[model samples]
Target: MEPDGDIEIFLVASPGLESVLCEEALARGFRDPTVIKGGVTIRGGWPEVWRANLELRGASRILARVAEFRAFHLAQLDKRARKVDWGAILRPDVPVRVEAACKGSRIYHAGAAAQRIETAIREELGAPISDDAEVQVKVRIDDDLCTISVDTSGESLHKRNHKEAVNKAPIRETLASLFLRRCGYDGGEPVVDPMCGSGTFVIEAAEIAAGLNPGRSRRFAFELLAGFDEAAWAAMRGAGGEGVDPAQITFRFYGSDRDAGAIAMSRANAERAGIAGLTEFRQHSISDLVPPDGPPGLVICNPPYGNRVGDKNSLYPLYGAFGRTLLSRFAGWRVGMVTSERGLAAATGLPFAPPTAPISHGGVRIMLFTTEALA
Candidate 1:
């Protein structure tokens, strides 16, 4: 595929959350994004690809679908793959890794397909192919159709570049942002995470409230592509940063954890992300959680499940105490809790509306349980 024309950009979503990512893409003004099975797709040029990498918070990674063709067998695939204009998108100086997957395709050997594409790129584009390359070329052969894409985001968007410190089994920023959206959070209201390990939710909330772009601090694989325009990318980023004044944001995001080290890490991460002034991190257990001095807001937490940290029998009391604390002290506040165990969530006794579709986090299927404002 040539880089001179409009490109199909795919925003990778965590499974079961494609609609949430689609909502974000539409809100961000991406042109005509359609929700697909695994992700959301939009059509645009290289600028759109760069902007998607820079402005989107919910996407795991952005892939630019550059080429699609019919290849009934290995020979056909090899011939067509060599004809692709790799030089238009790939750089000779930058290394690339080619990955291929086949399902119900006539040419079903994924390893051989990948090797063919790797050889084509190496011989045709003069680009080095390495397993460790940050630039990735993905080939999917489904039912004899070959689709090629480039992973534009070098690292997962969850890295966010500024969160250097993390607690055990911290929720990824991408998943946290989607969960916040699912709980009906916009930037207008304050957010509190009671069991804020590494403060993923709190920090993400603060950034969203301040109108900070999630990708502002990071570099993308697209920057090394042949079609990269540094000046245009810089202008887009500048415009995004100009939209919100962090100093003017009135609502404060709060996070509390029993471990003092987690609180310290949260504070440091907030500081690095430029939202420290808009957030508060304190060392406190779930039982000690209290609503800050403000109007009612959303309280979200990714607390531990029995499988991860402790035994289920011992955790029941913690959940019960958590439910009791909110019931007694946090009137008018809403709650969102994420846990892998249904029994643990049930132990809370909070009237959570039906749980969201289960999301995979940290290798376990978890769901978000949300409640209306407490009476």
Candidate 2:
């Protein structure tokens, strides 16, 4: 939680979730977020870290930079690593796990480098080291320049510690949050997921509408660091817990799945997230979907592609039917559809513009298409 200099905040996301990472950085008030290969890097302090963890649903983990130095080999690494006051960052009593990776560097042996760093932390700083550790410190040496990060989030943020029932091709919570943002989900408009599997999108939408922090109920590994601000964290958690409206949602979210079991599981997950009352889950096919009793709203869905189903050609008729139903039944409402196969999206017949960007989810590359002519 260094407050003086420019601190680095690393937001971990799924393979195809980079765009959402940048969008989240902007939404959370970060200026000019730059997306790297797999994550987003931004400059902020402890408050930003807290907000990112609490508010962002697309990030897998939020890491804070504690120290950085340049070293060509083990000797140089030992000198630089010993210079830093490790006691200020990690406590002597708390156990820690150290992981290191070296790429294109003179220090080719990663294990030896990690061992040297571990020696400095344990022997010099008196911190205990173990395989089963709650706090973890990661070291990355790229071309002889070392960057160390403290894993503020011990466990992956997607765990959320809530979902036990999942779908066959279930989408991760992080991906769902990003997809929702790319589709311009602002928490004030009605959202519908005709093929909602496991109810992730609908539940996330309801949480946004209810002003619930996505990370409020989870615990972080930073809590074990030395000089950790327990009172300040408690105050922040308490403040976040307040101002919750159990029944003051701004919009209605609807989700439906053809699978009866999926609908039942979605209901249970929504209830676990404390949004079951606000969300409606039903067992119905996309052909049977009708507009909810409200004004023209947003219809967002992640339809099945050939990845899990049998033949790609066989599902064209289903997509065509879905498109025909939308074209005929629901006019003047926006439709956002995500699919990996271009032909599958084309099968929908409704004229749609190509997605602004592409994202990778579950080892599949997916893009979004929105109908320009909602009417």
In terms of lDDT, which candidate is strongest? Answer: 1
For candidate 1, what is the TM-score?
0.97
Clashes of 1: 0
Per-residue alpha-carbon lDDT of candidate 1 for residues 5-34, written as tens digits (9 for 90 to 100): 798899999999999999999999999899
TM-score, cand. 2: 0.91
Candidate 2 off by > 4 Å: 1-6, 15-19, 30-34, 242-250, 308-310, 356-358
Local accuracy of candidate 2 as per-residue lDDT tens digits, 1-375:
343336788888775668677887787687457898778888877766766777778898988877888899899998898887788779999998888999999998888888888888998889989988989888999988998888888888887766789997777787777777877777887888999988888888888778787888888887888767778777877786733575665558999989998899999998888888789999988889998887777788888888766678888998998899889988878888888888899999977887746666677888878875376
Model 2 worst lDDT window (10 residues): 242-251
Computed on alpha carbons, the lDDT of every model, listed in order, comes to: 0.90, 0.82
Global Cα RMSD, each model: 1.5, 2.3
State residue 196's C-alpha deviation in candidate 1, in Å: 0.5
Q: Which residue pairs show collisions in model 1? A: none
